[model samples]
Target: MTLTKSTFTGLVLEYDSGIVPPPYSHVFRLALDWSKGDMIADLVLHYTEREDLSEEEILDEGFTLNDDYNYQGPLNSVWIKPLQQLYEKTRWTNKDIEEGGITVTPLEKGKDEGVKIPSDQEEWQLMAQDLIQAIYETVKKEAPLKVNYRSVQGDEIIDCSLTVHFSNREVIFEIAGKSRQINWEYAIQLMKIVFTPDYHYELAKEEAGKKRGAYIDCGDGFWHELGKGVVNIDPSFDAVSKIRKGFDELISE
Candidate 1:
């Protein structure tokens, strides 16, 4: 759907509702002029759900409810505006898959492109919006999930919001609820490309000394590079390494 001025605000509101309390649902509201008279704001929400609910139930709530609120930030508007522009100029196709349902054409890289953006405005917006929707769905699906997180120093978790525009980079992440921690596989996915191997090595060493060392620390570029090719561990690399000699070879090779 083409996001008009009114619709734009509604999108933000809907997304925001999924994170913070009502009347302050949105964590970030991003507005962009794009040299035009009108403005567009991309809103983002962060939520954490429990194992007791269904995805449908989560959607109905429209927000994640956890005992702790660690994932808090001013949603960066600068990132959203450019993403909107990039989406406007791109082309993306969706097709029904043999497996079932529909699949989005994976984003591709262009040669010397002008800031590789999302394929289509509507489709991209759908992802940002659907991230909340997906979480709601996952909550319903009863997937085994947990999170471990760190946040600003405070006695209580505080809700936050951010509005950005024309920024160079955008980042999105969340904190796991208390007693909930990130699965090593999923955490690795998020951390792979964002951090360097050396950084990840250091993080691994640091986390190894902790009680929950079963979770891999994909800090730095580890989050971003996960999809490309990298090994991940649930408990610890050393434990996994004993199970497979290829682990050392893979890292060095």
Candidate 2:
């Protein structure tokens, strides 16, 4: 197959449970943006042929047998109509479909190419640790709390046994895993105070679980730790009151 100017997108699906029955098993969707025209239509019509494959048959032919490339053969078994309704107008062209694992490059006459990683692993990890420390201190002094940490990338979610220590108006949260660290600083900033008793009671009820998982989990865990007196928070009520007083002073002036 002589693939001219083309763009390919890769999508990876990693199901944690591995054996999820029915619809839950369907994990991810990746679209390859084909630059020229509808490749799917060509495949249907048998228009393109593997005519001039070079010595490296696999590379020149532009196909791979790797699981990543195939991604369980087109997600057809699971994707159904209504949910999977793709009309001709809405249907993906050849350029839009991609195997989960294959990296496709597009050719263009005058296109600028640039690459950047979202964030450095080391920096994010350090920030995660700092946030963890802040959570620990705030809970310890104001609320009194204990916590365990867990993180995941790809399909592996591993637990990190974390403990916090504070000194010189500074706090630290430490964990052993890889050379890479967690983004604890942002985690701490994003933490919210939760009432554990309230959370437990709410979790027992069916109403709470219906909302999104992230929202409920964050709220429940945060308050549960708070109500249990397990962690301390800076800017306690007293501190907030003082800040308000200062603001009021400034306004009066």
Candidate 3:
């Protein structure tokens, strides 16, 4: 799968949430726009269980409970949105699967001459958008269940809704408005190698006495060129803690 900026943002958000889980039954969900990426982080409270308190009162109590945590901002920004209490939904996904779609004839690559690769930034951006669309279509058609994923990158990436596809054995993320798939296995493996329990994620080869991009830092920094190719193309240092947590949830599900 090709990793795009749009999808990258949600991965960031999810990673953030994992590093810090919600207070009890409370969960933080990021909002997404098809064109804008993520507009706000929504606070979903388990109101059904907290019947004794009013929403406003409950929120006030929570802030008093954890002063260090920030959600609502003084500036009233994208990082902060009004609190929303939502009830549990039923029948969003199906348990039983194995139903296939209509079989269609396959189309081979064009017989036309050699393709020209994009060398300019503008050309690459245009191509990235197209690639994102293609990945989205592939997942929508092939995967039985798809769900929305949000961002921890805050305003770093463009606003778009990202998605993940789940099967029995593994999971894949296409993400947001411009879809792109990445090598999920390779990404997880790389994350594991670089992740440290005490200090969290690192993008450096400490033994080498120098820092490097995560993609190349591992192997010859002893990184091998083998096995299904590269993952964590450019992971932000210290992000693996939360990102890996989110990854675990998806795989477990």
Candidate 4:
């Protein structure tokens, strides 16, 4: 939309990069002086009156305003691919999991086609740790982390919500309106089993147990832990058993 110099004053244009969810909008301000034949463009990200992402991150990853005087929009395209990758990598949400396990996908897939992992295992772990910490904080300060994990039951597929309430050194699973608590240490271990990159879950055709038809299993560590138990694992057998039951009952309606 073109306007006279005076009309363009105080004009702000919003671009929906489709990077973040709703209630978050990133906008661009155009200081156009058509009469004087001068214009300046600046990109700004905000949610309501505040910005959830740091200014530094946005500037570093998001596209800057065009210096070309004739430049025009098409702004709402998927332009913030870098930022999208960052969000998908460093965050764990309901979208990251399916059938009670993490989805297998590339973490980086950065600008450089040859680049993949952001360095080494330590860096990957650090990013994972940050996501885990954010989950803990949300559970502690905000609300319980609620995830709707999908279940495959023979010919039926259903999604069920699992709520994790973290407090002190333990976490509780509220399932079927009943709550079961386990040590934070054990919770972390289970998360690793579900979120590890080595696993590629495929629903088994044959039923293994009452809920096995719904909860698919494929990861090696998952089976090893169930078979003879890991050599170094000295888990509370009763608590582990209870955790299994809770997960199985997740799809129970």
Candidate 5:
């Protein structure tokens, strides 16, 4: 028999988390299929976070698989070995394949049009390294300084200070006299969204005839906005541009 690789995207694997109180449910992605029987299947898993859930709610609700797509197949017993191999090769802990339901459907016709899955831990590390390097280069021009900005917190204008230290891979932000250290990867992503040409233009236009600050929610638990007379060497802008460039290069590779 000829071994072939059948790649599936958007496959949801649902299982029981073995938790009481609400009987927590868990979901994972089976992105690839590599089997040695009739067909070999390799699994690529995706990670997700429920933004609508609070910490306690998430713990109670358990894990949830994406229900956007569905899969249908006659799961053969011969495929069990391959699935077990996959479990050992990756981060998946449980071996209860029978308990976890797997669905396979045609989500993408070509590789180019495939779904944009979440980055794996390895990929995240590489991206983090690139972001740290880029931020380091950008911050070198002005070391040990703080930039001020205005942000809206519950309908109030608040002052925020961004401090970049050359020795660390984190950006320090002081809001309401409380300091938080945001990692380079997260800060880069936030800046990319806020500093985009369209978003920046819109912010400028909206603030042209208004007193309210133009703010964008970073979605990482912080709101960033431009302050009056902020300097030309804004770290956010520099880091965002570098991140965009790095991402483009990564994709091309």
Candidate 6:
């Protein structure tokens, strides 16, 4: 069957009576507004059983609940099942609605170009810290060395120190006061940051040739290179060679 706003309204109404106690039965009203492509469902429970109650008393006794879901593709194909599940599983809480109580499908097919969800800074910081730690541990496994790395937390750049034990294959991170197993893959990924300028230049050149922007994930995070002014510059061979030599010396020790 074709899914429309009315279909959603009917589904919500079907589950409204289940939301409250029996005494509050038949007092729930469900409203759906779809004027803007986005669907909003508003559920209000009124004190309808007590006809003798004054309008003010009724207003005081009623409560409202709201949920929003985005719509873009065919409703029947994309949202009907999740909508039904959301209605069935919704519950009232002392605070705001519990997370995961509502599930909305993303508009993959209809998403507008150039529209992007902003990244969570805190989450990105945490990921960066983990990657740095993992890389430190991996290098420490190869040799006895003292490595210094920096991670960004909020507006602060925190410096970290690591002591690598080649015999036991353990890396002790002083900042976190913890030790983790070596992760070689993560170490290689972090090494890319040391050569980022080189890769960025190459990427910019490639994008200039293609006349489009290039998206790159050099194991750390996503980076974009737009084709605007592409300058042919040599990758930082000296810096990369120095880093390799230093690592080799550490392993020899």
Best by lDDT: 5
lDDT of 6 by residue, 56-105 (tens): 65456553221112222212122233334443444323332222112122
Going through the candidates in the order shown, the clash numbers are 38, 39, 21, 0, 11, 0
Write down the lDDT that model 1 would get. Answer: 0.30
Query: What is every candidate's alpha-carbon RMSD to the true fold?
Result: 15.8, 22.7, 21.1, 20.0, 17.9, 24.4
Task: Give per-residue CA lDDT, model 2, range 1-253, as digits (tens).
Answer: 2222232212111112134332222222222222333111011111122344333554443443221212111222111121112111122224422221112222233232321111232332232233223333433432322233333335544333222232112223334443322343322332322221133433333222222111122322432222222332443443323322322332233
TM-score against native, each model: 0.25, 0.18, 0.19, 0.26, 0.27, 0.19
Considering lDDT, which of the candidate structures 1 and 3 is the better prediction for this target? Answer: 1
Which lDDT values do the candidates have, in the order given? 0.30, 0.26, 0.28, 0.34, 0.37, 0.34
lDDT tens readout by residue for model 1, 1-253: 3432222321222222343343223333222222232323332333433455665665576544432222222333333444455345555444322221212221122111112223344454444543333333333433222222212223443211111111213222333322222233333333332222222342233322222112232332121112122244443443233312222222222
lDDT of 5 by residue, 121-185 (tens): 34323332332233334435225434444434355665555554433445676767788775655
TM-score of 2: 0.18
Candidate 1, 17: how far from true, in Å? 16
Mind giving the per-residue lDDT tens digits that candidate 4 earns over 1-253?
Answer: 2222223222222222234432333332221111223222233333332246456544565423321112222221111232234424543333421111112122121111121222233433333333333333433434544433334456665434444443223456554456666554455555544443222233223333334232323322122222222221345344334434555654342
Q: Which ten residues in a row have the lowest lDDT in candidate 1?
A: 159-168
Q: On TM-score, who's better, 5 or 6?
A: 5
What TM-score does model 6 achieve against the real structure?
0.19
Mark the regions of model 2 whose C-alpha exceeds 4 Å error after superposition.
1-146, 151-155, 175-188, 193-198, 201-253
Candidate 1's C-alpha runs over 4 A off are 1-77, 92-204, 207-253
Q: Which stretches of candidate 6 lie over 4 Å from their true place?
A: 1-143, 152-155, 188-253
Q: Which ten residues in a row are the worst by lDDT in model 5?
A: 9-18
Q: Provide the lDDT at 166 for model 4.
A: 38
